[model samples]
Target: MATEVSSRLFYHFLGALKRTHSFSNFSFPLGLPQTSMSYSASKTWISPQTKELETWTKIRDSIMRISPRSPFIPKTFADWLEHRLAIKEDQLRKVVRKIARISGRDDRQETTIHPVLGVKEIEDRRALVLARETIWRQSLESFPGRRLAPWPSYEEYKHEGDDRSKSGYRRFLPLPRDPGNVTVNWKQRKPLPQYLFDEVGRRTTVDNEEDKEPGLDELLAMEFVGASLILLLDS
Candidate 1:
């Protein structure tokens, strides 16, 4: 009975989604669906969970294509993304300060915070995480590594130096990179300093009490938007 409902939602999802999804046929000018975007996994028949996944995947993918720069960006995600970016910017500035201080260079005003760089990072991260969390929640709610696929095993790749005796099957375990890892742009030749990834002992760095922060109204607004998150999930 549950499978019947799931199947219905999945079919409706396909019809409703064709128009809005980032991975839809229209998204690719070449008329090719994205490599990992298709719903079919095994046989012609999809299971109940796969149906639920397809339904949620369509919805999540639809929301991700929305642009903050667009005139019609939904208010809630924008508010959340904006607030997150502001918080991250503050953190990035502190990192830049530490890097500058450690370089034996006097803290020049320009190096303190590059406004353009901060804006670029915030925009990029906002888009990526918005896509990420949308997909993550969808997949996690549905269940992972089943019906769809599992992480590839070590036997999937061949390396010259690896020894099967000592390495055992452990060498075959998938070592996936984190999607949120800092991406270095070789074309721009911009490198984030190493300290950014370094572990800080138990000591917590706190901003001075006198430092100004964005008003309560701003944080209140983001929280207010978050309160309506169910609507977003359903949308």
Candidate 2:
């Protein structure tokens, strides 16, 4: 599920990246144009949960170091890339404060408050989640009978590396539903619009063989898009 979600997000990320001209601006692209971006245990043995959190951390920290305290809205892919990379440490601290306030729990305690689903940051977070789900749905429709995994909950990834420590660990509020009910009803799920399916299909080989990995371009697109999605939701 994690793999599927990330891959789908990457698929969208590539389109946005291209539209923003992110690839052309960089002197050297993050991943080779021909390299596979699909999730592969052989590429990196880390768990998807840990890898995603780590990727978010890396992109955020890297952006904070390079971006200004008050950055501008990106006008191009390069600009967007730069903007996405520019995160502030204080912004993260502020999220902690907001989560604490909403959950009525001390920051020091483990929280189950889903970071992106609550009312305070509802709009942006909700959009991010929906965007992911939308992409996943389209992928399912594009290649019928594919055995893609389910998307993990926003709450599940909230504490990816927290080990219940008081010093560095952070927790969030859980989703307001029975875990069993959270699963999607396959029969009732909606597919991506035909136009989008056609566009995305023409853009990349999203309908690859079940066992084959995505090509390099698809993988690279996901990396930037996936990281951007994380930051956007966090914001």
Candidate 3:
């Protein structure tokens, strides 16, 4: 792919030279096949042209780095290019908008809106209790078919006459016929602090008799997880 592009550019340069005074320096006639020329003659014309084309290709690629199609263009380079060209903010924004529309691209600056996280403290104890209860009930009720059953048992029969009621096989089945429902025994916990720092302090306090005090590392980890859980539940 690269070789083909270079060859095309070289030929185009040669065509452009036909109109200029530099055409005579290219020793061979344009009409003749390149194979017909001596190695030295072809080398004389091709080498300089190849070098010139490579330089031009490098310059073109540098310019193209600012283009939306170039996948690997760095942000710093793009910024530098815009500054060097004295591009206005509006012009740049317009270019970005057009590129986004054409390529279905999402520019973080224009497209992304980060959600604002605000922790609203639960002032009412009743509300928190209700929420906990609702969540627990929902979890328990979600799987209606789940039930506890006894393990199967089996016993050998002595004779055919001993299987009078034909209940010998019944021993192999689960003993209990009734389906046991799920129950959640939610232990009431002391209220968390209105402020996050107070909550962390309270959790780490060895003086509190109602709850077990965690180690320093464990307290920090619990605080982090608790904060995340509160945010998730609130949302």
Candidate 4:
């Protein structure tokens, strides 16, 4: 599932990069048949990156505002792509924070407390959960029905090279000695939407006796139906 999700995201990212590159090269033709001031007045230059960011923000907002009861769902390929992008953005934020902490560049500790779900919210979530389970079961029973291998237990995994004192296995590895010369400006990167993050957290925390909600990538792999439903319900 992880491999599948990664491959899908990789293609999406590649296509986005290509689009950005193509848009950057776009410009008005040098020779216009009509010498009208309207052309010059309408000439507005927006960086491809800026345009991309704006488009992303709009999509993210639209997805986040969707209600669970709405018939509109991420059933189409395009809708799923947008959903995947939103999940990817959230994952990127997590990765950035983790890297910053590992490099001793971030020290702030923040706690988030989500509000309790209302009666209507609970019913909506239950409906979504049922939908998710149906999809998941169908996927499992599809052609070439083969069970996946169980993940290795902590005791079975090797930890010989790990630094026991550190939180992570690779924490002992040194970072670049000259950190001031970094090329990428991390601060310039857009952050995950707060509402999206909150929604993801809320949905993932929903408990079920038969099957627990999976991680974001797993949800993406399962292609759960519903608009903004991707992040609206918890694993």
Best model per TM-score: 4
Number of the candidate with higher TM-score, 1 or 3: 1
Sliding window of 10 residues with minimal summed lDDT for model 1: 190-199
Worst 10 residues of 2 by lDDT: 20-29
Q: After superposition, how far is residue 119 of candidate 2 from its true place, in Å?
A: 55
Candidate 1: misplaced stretches above 4 Å?
1-75, 105-235
Q: Best-fitting candidate, measured by lDDT?
A: 4
* C-alpha lDDT of all candidate models, in order: 0.40, 0.42, 0.40, 0.44
lDDT of 3 by residue, 1-235 (tens): 6445545554454454432223323343334333334655644334544443344445456666657566554334333333322333444567679878978854555765654234554432212432321212213232233342222223222222335346554223222223332231111212221322223344344666657654545555655668677567759
**Candidate 1, residues 134-213: lDDT per residue as tens digits?**
22222333223212223333443343126543566445433332223234322232222222113235343557755645
Clashing pairs in 4: 203-233, 203-234, 204-234, 204-235, 213-235
Select the stronger candidate by lDDT from 1 and 2: 2
So what's the TM-score on candidate 1? 0.16
Tens-digit lDDT track of model 4 for 1-235: 6545744674566454423233443333423243335665865665433444444455445666875345565543455556656766766677789888899854486666765433334321222443332222323332133223233323223332343435454433221121222353333323322222234335545577457655555655556475456457754
Candidate 3 least-lDDT 10 residues: 184-193
Relative to the unseen true structure, what is the C-alpha lDDT of residue 87 in candidate 3, on a scale of 0 to 100?
31
In candidate 3, which residue pairs get closer than 3 Å at backbone N, Cα or C atoms, i.e. clash? Answer: none
Worst 10 residues of 4 by lDDT: 173-182
